[model samples]
Target chain A: MLTRFENRPHALDVIGVSVAFGEVCVIDNVSFHVDVGSTLAIVGRNGSGKTVLLKALIGAVRASGTIRWAPETRIGYVPQKLDIQRDLPLTGRDFLNAKADVARAPATDAQRVAGLVNLSQSIVDQPIGTLSGGQFQRLLLAFALVGTPSVLLFDEPTAGVDEPEEKSVYALIHQLQQNEGLSVLVISHDMTQVQASADHILFLSHHGSYFGKTADMLNSERLQELHGPTVAHLRE
Target chain B: MTYATGPGAFLIPLGMAAAAGLMGSIAVMRRMALASDALSHIALPGIAIALLVHVNPFLGGLIALVLGTVLVWAIEYRSRIPTDVVVGVIFSAALAMGSLLASGDELIEALFGAPNTSDSFNLIGLGAASLVIVFIVRYRSQLVIRLVSPDLARPAGINVPRLDLLYLLAFALTIALGLRYLGVLLMGSLIIIPAATAMRLGTNLRTMQTISVAIAMLATLSGMLLAPVLCLAAGPLVIVIAASIFFLSLAVRRA
Candidate 1:
């Protein structure tokens, strides 16, 4: 049945979402919903449409889907990577205020957001081109914090950062989730992250998928059949 | 700058430099400097067509560039094709058509410009100056946001496609303003060099923009002054000087 998820009360309610590039269908019919103050992790292999799904959710790319956000539920996003030109003279403070009025946006707003992401005030004045990988990730997190978004979406947030930094970043995100009641949707290949932070899981393949509570989704017989023995080890 | 010609000669390049310096910074930040360069060359055939039909060359170049800009915009946003390749194809065709249509002194004048002629004085100089001032004063931040990432700009309620079209139109207009002085081939150099030099020297967007305009003004003024002594055209001399400034900034950056 065709479903309309618009103007609903859920933090994010997606129904019959599908994306196609030319003749190839990247993401087939998929549907799911997340409540406020919860974390959802989307898991898929390379080319299984994980990134596309996240982009579609944020309306970055067009897709045939019914995506509804609860009224006034502002969104913030941290991309998997941003290829900022090395020569641009953009400072971290400039990045944070890219979408805000520098004059009207209080200075303390940046400080407060920076505090949430554990970023120092001094670092915000430094050029973004000079930042270390981990520092850059923290700045990206601060970027999402600027507008006080109720829903935050992160796409492979630690893809290029050091592996150890992954846990720390997710921990920061988890902290934000609890403290602000922010609905979190993250796409990650790290099973540890999936096990650690996700309240629900959406596992997608090109033609088929699974979506449910994290515990139930991990123990599914179909998931085991699809991913072989790896699924069993992922269960926590 | 001591000009052997009338004071009006200095006005055109001065205005052109201001527009190029500011707009070039946007092009550089968006990583579209090469695309801007290619688009300048695509104006050649239109100038030739205008010369053939006895119409204003600026009108012809503007029409061609607007069409080219639209084509580049369509190809870039419509599909996954890389922008440089699409613009490159159009540029090459325009260059060939221009070569076929013009020759001898006409070709030399079209490529290097003949700004000493009386017709060089136009309201475009005033229009370009106003555009530079207004753009810097108001739209700089929004333009920066759009260039940074359309994804971010969209959530901010910025109409990404419309803003992109507006920027491209402004780029075309800026380039057109310089066609009498810098010509089709060399106008893009004025647009790219000053901004690139300023980028090496700055730590923030405002500083970069300020430095870009300053460098552009210095280069244009100095080049105009030296043109008579060097027996060279002001446009090309300005480019050489701007390049020297860029390398000097690189040295400063390394230091």
Candidate 2:
């Protein structure tokens, strides 16, 4: 008998994936998966393939490995949008209402974005260029949620954001996974955030360190070796 | 048609206004302003060269513009001092060469006085410019403003390089044909000031585009009307006015 899932079956299976940029081998033959309705926290130091791996999965980066996903997989991508001078003429309502202009109707995009970011109605009509840093990050997050995809990939979603905002964002992510059974993939250096939000963990070091359930993989010796020197300074 | 006093005299200001408003917006944005400026400069005799052969100056200018775009792309894609500096040097050199090629007294009619725009030529110039603006808006509209990401400009997306090339063709055609009124030496200023002013006043790309066009139109019209009455070159007159507006905007932004 075929097993019944509450939501559609969406799984990300990566087998022996290796990536190279010029002379450096970044993601060295890594492999892992995140079951539907669960969270995968990718943790590592600066320059780990965490970001590179995410880019590869998004098809922005060329990869030597295979990433096979279920046919119904919806990818909600949150890419970096902070250039010195951004030419996008988006407004808060454009983000909240999700419309670029009256000439271009954005109702469906707006509703989906509104669902994910949890933006208050206070700033809907505000010009996007004038938004605060935190607001901008949230806007990118909302951008990711626009398609209501099965798999949500976020790169440093809460880097410059404050603690409260970070918690709420994580909480919302948790709620989405619990309610909709969405597969969440988040990259972060924050241990507390990982513990709060992830069920499984992928330690992305230069060397492939650990990949398994979050609790079991943390105590592994390879991980301990990698995390040993930095653990004291990471408390903050 | 009467040589000095005729119905076609209206084109002097109208053409100047269009060129100034359109190019000014591009210049102030600084995205592809240098390229636009370079093409406009090179298009001096670019049109005259075409006119000399009894072909369309607009098409001739377009050929030059295409060549210039290709050159810039080649240099930047291969070796670079950054595209902006490359564009500036190219603009200066091309304009100098074009001016030298187009220096005779008959060239004065195409450049300074614009007595050449009589009957069908006026119609052609006006119609062609309007079409180019429409084309840029429909096809190269993003070049007028900003985009989300450079990658967003990739294939099956809003490709910046392609948009730039297409926009430059239209720009070359307009500037080459627009030579009937605005002249060459003073063309670059018009493309920069109004857009710069608009940028200071607006936050989004769309707002910047709209405000820049509006400002350019105002500057172009007023300058065109004042130049002949004041016995000044229409192109330079418009640039000065646009520059004044730009400073005013900068002062306002600072305040």
Candidate 3:
């Protein structure tokens, strides 16, 4: 899918990057590169340091070794389901306006990104706590889109959304990638979406990791060894 | 002692109450209700020490509150402990120590506040209260983002640690502003009750803040006016009014 970007400049490069908390080594010697305007899917089982790896890439956590991004790279991050109180007084518009103000984006950017995510004005005006799971996901997407970031990092973007809305969320990400020319790094458990959208797959596990083209990784035996019998369905 | 009852006397408390409303809204949203309440108690020991040393108790309380804020921030940052836990342990100790140091009427006044005896420090308190309001309004966007998630705020170009420090400082200042009227025992109530009420009734950020400020000012005005008439202390009366509003807000169903 991303073959067109084979000759494009690298958006990110990771060399022997490792993160450890005290005695526990989470991610060790992980290395990969993402091309501009391509999507890289990070697939792994729970507690496999997938979220930690994303944090390292975004400088949210301490990691040893080299992880570099293209000069002037701006990243927008969408984290997993946040434990927001149902009675929280913040509206979606307030959340978006906060991002716009901090990012120093124009006043119009909030409306533009809200439109991009297909969030209605009425929905955006409602308190964030009252928003449905899918609406909250869209709000986060609009938040990420506000600064016109060149790259996006999503950690289980649709974790709490319904099955029907999950597909639309990925579709929105795909559409945004095409329209905005974004490079995406996402962590997800849904392999079907990965096969549909990802140019490359980075399979991380307690044993080791495999980083390569999506098709090749799906076909490789190492994926079976690292992912066990679970990934056997992907070969079909 | 001749207590100041001029119109000028009312201005500082009103401004301080408004600042408490604004600061408390963020504090409650951050889920720091217990921590903020405990944080005011840290001022008690400072007041006791100031009385012993023959210094202005307000200055002493302000210094102690600032120091306590920094300590809480540092411990929370270094150990990854929750802010409430850190504040709880530290401020509780301060309260115990304060009770031991001051005695009789002086201690009673420090814990529950006394009527204003002089207007000499009113100007400085008003200025400090204005600074806190300005800080909350100017940096509310950043504060809101940080409250939601530090990771999101960091990516959006906010310095999360620095913002946290500044916010804690503003919170301390607001508490200090109200200490004269509400005392260490009741100041935190003024901050939390109005914001908690606003959280229940407000549909959005703007509404929440507006309602919180209005409730705070109303409570302050009513308590200040009614305390002398009813032969009651203003600090307890103000908190009672704020708590009453909070209880009343429970009756109005949220939209």
Name the candidate that leads on TM-score.
3
lDDT accuracy of residue B196 in candidate 3? 98
TM-score of chain B of each: 0.92, 0.75, 0.97
lDDT of 1 by residue, B54-100 (tens): 88777777788888888887887887577788888888998999889
Per-candidate TM equals 0.91, 0.76, 0.97
Indicate the fraction of true inter-chain contacts that candidate 2 also forms.
0.12
- Writing each residue's lDDT as its tens digit, candidate 3 over B91-174 gives 989989888989998888888877574647888998999999999999999999888888888778888889999999999999
DockQ winner:
3
| Candidate 3 docking classification | high
TM-score of chain A, every prediction, order shown: 0.91, 0.83, 0.97
Over A177-225, each residue of candidate 3 has an lDDT whose tens digit, in order, gives 9999999999998988888899988888888777998888877876777
Rate residue A44 of model 2 by lDDT.
Answer: 84
Candidate 1 chain B lowest-lDDT run of ten = B1-10
**Candidate 2 structure, TM-score to reference:** 0.76
Query: Over the true interface residues, superposed, what is the Cα RMSD of model 3?
Result: 0.8
For candidate 2, the lDDT comes to 0.63
